[model samples]
Target: MLAANAEEAEKFRKETEAGDYDLLEGEIWWRDRHQMLIDHGYQLRPRLRPGWEPSWNNSNKNPLYCEDAHVGLRLAGGGTIDAVRIMDGKDVGIRPIKRVSSERTIFKNLADAQHLTGQDQHIAHILDTFEDDRDPDLVFVVIPLMIPVWFIASSLKTISGIVDLFKQLLEGLSFIHSKNVAHRGLWSYIMLDAPSMFPRGFHPSDYFQDHSGVHQIKVLPPCKASGPVRYYFADFRHSIDVGQDAKHLIFGYEHPVGADFDAPEWTAIGTYDPFRADVFIIGKIFNEKFISKYENIDFLSSLVEAMTAKKPEARPTAADALKRLQTITSTQSFFTLRHQLVEKDSKEPESLLSENINILLDVAFHGLKIALKMPSRTISLVRRMKRGSKEKETAK
Candidate 1:
């Protein structure tokens, strides 16, 4: 419904024409839309797109997403911090998600992004805290998400679904970069969502006594058997041991925090190279997002890419990395559960020439027209402003 003119309205209509526009389904409370099992706080689709709900009453449960509780406290320096209870096992070698926490450009404020970890939806959320000179104790700033009893253990059915979810993580990172904040804490948990009903190792899900570990048992992760496992980063209380004023390496998705996620220029002055440090970390996320995991080669290549740059300025920003991923997914061929991924030979001279010709024609026909009109449009805008100003001056 948000449109500047008939052209925009028609564009919206065309965008939906490719896919049937189903009124998004969910419940309505206080004139607000709420999904099944989703916290009443959620206002849009679980994936966080903007759309309208049909009647505000969908299934009480969509078996798709989850959420977590809030954490952290405020500090004297205006920074907030919180802590997560990291399970001893399930992850040991896994590193924090990203390096250098930030919020403006690359990061996002997910109402329930924190709770999607280890459940059906595959994602990890950034949560928890760290120390700062501005505060006497770690600051707890963000609200934790609450996961549903269902929507756990999403299946790896299609790589596209996973990719779609994963790309959102990059969007969050891009949002962080735009804001010029660092995502010092990135990981499987922080990037993914965590289920709340998972059986604690301390508490077994026993229908009957299992003295021999042979009881009729179900090993359902706190998640429903629908999608891939989600992850959520906890313990932000220690998130910034070396970040912020001091630039500590927050841990989760990356293997080694500072050295691995840091840029080339940061090798010597990482403690002070905050922006470059963040960009290097983002390159790692980009490589993994577009390229499938193989041997440690993926990790190694990411390391080389993120750190090999001569300077942090030479490194790619999170937004830049997202652009790379966009090109990769839209153009490059990659293996999936269904498709055979392979690179087609671009050196086929005839095909290449034909493609180039088509592109040239399209640009000259459509793109060039739009480009030429933009300057005239700007001139018109300025002319309108000047005319208004003259009228105001004459009245005075």
Candidate 2:
């Protein structure tokens, strides 16, 4: 893989110097087999089509201003691509994996578990898999196209959003752990199924644009009003199923130590419990993306600290963390849950005032929706909070 990457880098260098950048050197594979992919029920973008000419070519307008200019927009990983499923027209991700890799076996296990137990709700489902006709040793895995967790989290304005996100993450980890599978890397693989949030669907590359990569995306409503937003754990390349041997320890990985973010215990020297390492990875993700950035979410400080403890044995299991989160959140009132989080670095006092105003307006809208018998998760959450408060009062 290292040699292949280096070869691609060299090709890229040559293409840059030649001033012939129609298609990226790495993207040549997709373009070369465009018709083959189409015949297999996936449609690549216009830019990737064979014999296609750029619309911006010889035009007075800047290429950057044209939608076709974004052909170079690709995921960090080189082999993966975003395409539209020909049958349903829904966007999907296509990733190639060697036949000998464990990823295919892991996905099969997850799929079986999801079908029988229905506990794989937080895990990404593999849509389809097909062999590459050119290389019998290579196969492409198709998955639902999901937005990055950070992107959806950044759009969130209230504590409910953050709480819900963490709950799903913890629940996901717990489910995978229950199956005796340890996801050694958990940071960048976390994604959200938020198709409802964007009415027109978003471009896989430039999320700010619509599916066509031309117009700006149109969002429907805040997460609270948009029904339940489901989060999923993707990328099981580094994951391992210990089966009944939950006590098994991993020596190290043949690949990199971590999946984008390195856990403290992943020194690649000695054997360590991958399950506990998974816990720390989740904690690191939450801390880096949320706790460190938001000032008002201090309620998670102790939980985060415990999950990221230096001692692998000291960190709470995914189940424990989920329960702790529920207990912590249950005590807060609906108004408190609806409280908008202030960014720690947000020095502007007026921003807080604006957030407060938005919260009030959201509450009013939710109340109106409730009165009209319209769908609102906020109403359901408020009712649960009320019930909890009543239960506490009776206990007292």
Candidate 3:
């Protein structure tokens, strides 16, 4: 297998030198390593032509090089299709044993979490692993392929759709926390779905052009789906086990920097409860992505606010947030209520007032409470203003 990989790499190198394909240094390295996996009985689909490439430089000569290629893999025994995420082991800055140990820990954490949650559908499962014989340092982790949540959000027709998706995510998070795993990185891209058709790659330069000219660069559109969607959390590279106690603290500056949804605690100088950080991450997603964009579902404002509370201790547990979601879904029925109110208000103002008298009464009740809380002088001033306004109306 080693000799075969070396031969293939030499062949590819010769082909590239002959001007057959303009391959980058990282691309050449990936092809060479991938051949070894194939020799070990792993069947990979044809390289998706025009596949997306990371914008960052990945040349072997560059000190900051890293591989971010995504490829489809046929699971052994033809059970299911999965993705192979190829990582350059050198970039992690850790010994091979420690890195492999971390991978084992993640696998165990997910396995235990699945059992505790009864094989929850919202968590992405790892299928297999492969070690590159050619580059003993490179690791290939296999996981289910999924569509990004942002793409699904584009097709959402109502606030109710968004709520249902979020509910599933909260349930998944609750289960993950129950098993003492902290997904330090929780964002929209982390949420994904298994769709019917595999996505085809396209060159960004084909669709987008600058004044200079079209620069042919491969990229994949965000994944999309047509029917029912099941959201799952993926990318567990940053995941950590906090133990079943839920209060276990993990210290690390490991969270992705400059991520919009990253928890503020991640930037602190000392140890922090990762579970609480997870809550903040989810809350930031809900607050910025869903609630802020859609005004009709403003009822969720308080829930997200509580989840993203500045003080870690003040933030609700994932389980508490899940329970709150259930209550909101059952009681408020905001989508239906919002539509009805809009229709009624548009068709007949008087009928709308009569039908929603309770809403008006509630407003007045709160106003009266505010008035009662004011000082005597403030109350007297309000009364004088009211009388003055009435006199002006009478004069008119």
Which of the numbered candidates is closest to the native, going by highest lDDT? 2
Candidate 3: stretches off by over 4 Å: 1-21, 40-99, 115-117, 186-189, 196-228, 244-246, 252-254, 334-396
* Positional deviation of residue 168's Cα in model 1 after best superposition, in angstroms: 2.6
Clashes within 3 Å, all models in order: 97, 0, 0
The candidate scoring highest on TM-score is: 2
TM, every model: 0.34, 0.83, 0.58
What shift in Å separates residue 37 of candidate 1 from its native position after superposition? 24
Residue-level lDDT tens digits of model 2 in 81-171: 8889999898898888887777778867776787787555687878888888878888888888887776666777778888888888899
lDDT (tens digit, per residue) of candidate 3 on 1-396: 121455555664454356443444433444444456445444332332235333222222211111222222222221223223344211110011123655456655676568675766466665555554655654555555554566445445445556777788888788777667777764644655433322332211121221111232222212123344567776565677766664688665767656767887887777888888888888888787777765567778888999999889999999999899888878864324323122212456775556366344544575675677789999899899999999999999
Model 3 scores a C-alpha lDDT of: 0.55
- Give the runs in model 1 whose Cα sits over 4 Å from its true position: 1-162, 186-191, 194-264, 270-273, 285-310, 332-396
- Model 1, span 225-313: residue lDDT tens: 33344433232321222224444343233323444234344336323445456555545543544343322123225433743366655
Looking at model 3, how many pairs of residues clash? 0
Ranking by TM-score: 2, 3, 1
Question: Considering only N, C-alpha and C atoms within 3 Å, which residue pairs clash in candidate 2?
Answer: none
Relative to the true structure, candidate 1 reaches a TM of: 0.34
Off by over 4 Å in 2: 1-20, 73-78, 215-228, 252-255, 345-349, 367-396
